[model samples]
Target: MILNGIITGLIMGGILSLPVLGVAVIYGITGIPNFAIGVIGVFGGFLTWYFLSFNMGIAILVGVVFCFAIGYIIQRILLTPISERGGDSTLFFIVTVSLGFVFEGLMRAIFPRPSISLALPRIGTINIAGVTVEGFKIFALLFALGTLVIIRLLEEHTEIGKSWQATSQNLKLAKLIGIKTNRVFSIASGIGCALACVGAIFWGSLYNLNLMTGWDLGFLGFIIAVVGGIGNIWGGIISALIMGMVMSFSGYLLGGMWQSVILYFIVILVLIVAPKGILGSERSL
Candidate 1:
């Protein structure tokens, strides 16, 4: 039973890490706590379901495009103006939170039903070590790890990624050095949204889709970001895995309701011990 719980938690942690990484990326670059991250993900899942009849690949592609567009639009139309007016981080945070609520309402209107299920094409199950795991769960983990590797490679080898790193390090200096900070922000937002879309698809495959799914993911992602150290993508991933283990153990030993209680308690203890998170830097927002 313990081993089973651990395996399940690890799989779930992989899926949950997707959105948390997205949040970390956006926060690292733009210093905005994008509360609407999950909403964008939920929207993508809905798009996948809407277009599932055509082709799964096409559905996923459309969802990614839609999420990218939404993120870009939000950054360009709303966030840009606010930033130009000298909005602080607090203001940016409030704006994002408000946007999250607005998007949630829009989602509720579009998906008025209580719940909907959109299962991925099953690849059956596989036995690993003595435990049986769903094939889709393996796919989701590999997909997430692959995506992270790609992002890391881009950050190391690409001019665009270098610019992002520079901007993240010092926005004023980046602007002075002729790096188009606004464009970088927009691109970061798009990339984050794309990641969120991927997470949404994987999550939708595992469970029923509902309006609240986005909120749940976004909130949890936020916690994971804080726990992993906001603006540290790798830290977020590691923290997510740790959280998964804790959640799994707590759920197994105690009860389902106690899972969150224990998780939050651990987070508080971590914060008290290391306010900057396990791998977080002093500059982490």
Candidate 2:
């Protein structure tokens, strides 16, 4: 049972890391808190489910591409202009909340069903010290870790990554040096939402996706990101794993009802003690 809990926690944390990365990446690069990413991701999940009858790979691609487009379009048309107009974090918060609502409505109207479970192929199970775990779950965890490594490499070696770092460090300086800051913001936001969509796909395959799951995911991801140190990618991953353990243990000991309550209470305490976060936002994205 103990081993099971540990594995479960890691899997959960791995799935959650995607959205946490989404929040970290977006906030890191654009300084915008996009509360809508989760909902848009769910919207993409529904799209994948809708197109599942055609082909699995294509459906998944459609979902991810659709989300990327949505994120890109929204950032380009809506958020960037507001940022240019000096919109603060508080304003972005409110705007993104509204955007979430809009996407949620779209999901409801278009999908018809309020809940769905994706039927992804299962890759059997693995036994470790007499504790059996699904192979896909392990894959999810490894995928999460691998993605972080890829992102780190991208930001370190690629031209786009260099531009993202420069723009994030100093927008005016980046713009003066011939970087298209707005385009960078849009692409960053697109990638963030795309990551969230992938998380949603994993979640839907593992359990279920519902109309309200997006809010839960978005809020929880944000909480983990904040506790890990908002805008800090590595910190976000650490925070996600710890919180995943907390949630797993609490759910086992207390019950599902109290799982999130405990997390929120701890988050409050963490914030009170360290106003910034555990790692204090050192190294955004």
Best candidate according to TM-score:
2
- Model 2 scores what on Cα lDDT? 0.92
| Model 2 weakest 10-residue run by lDDT | 276-285
Can you list the residue pairs that collide in candidate 2? none
> Over the stretch 147-214, how does candidate 2's per-residue lDDT look in tens digits?
89999999999999999999999999999999999999999899999999999999999999999989
Against the unseen true structure, what C-alpha lDDT does each candidate score? 0.84, 0.92
lDDT of candidate 1? 0.84
Question: Backbone clashes per model, in order?
Answer: 0, 0
Error of 2 at 230 (Å): 0.7
lDDT of 1 by residue, 1-285 (tens): 878888878878888888987898888888777888898888888888888889989988999999988888898888877877889878877888788888778777876465777767999999988899989888888887787788888888999888988888998999999999998889888888888888888888897778888888888887888888888878888888889888888988998899999999999999899788888843322
Model 2 reaches what TM-score against the true structure?
0.98
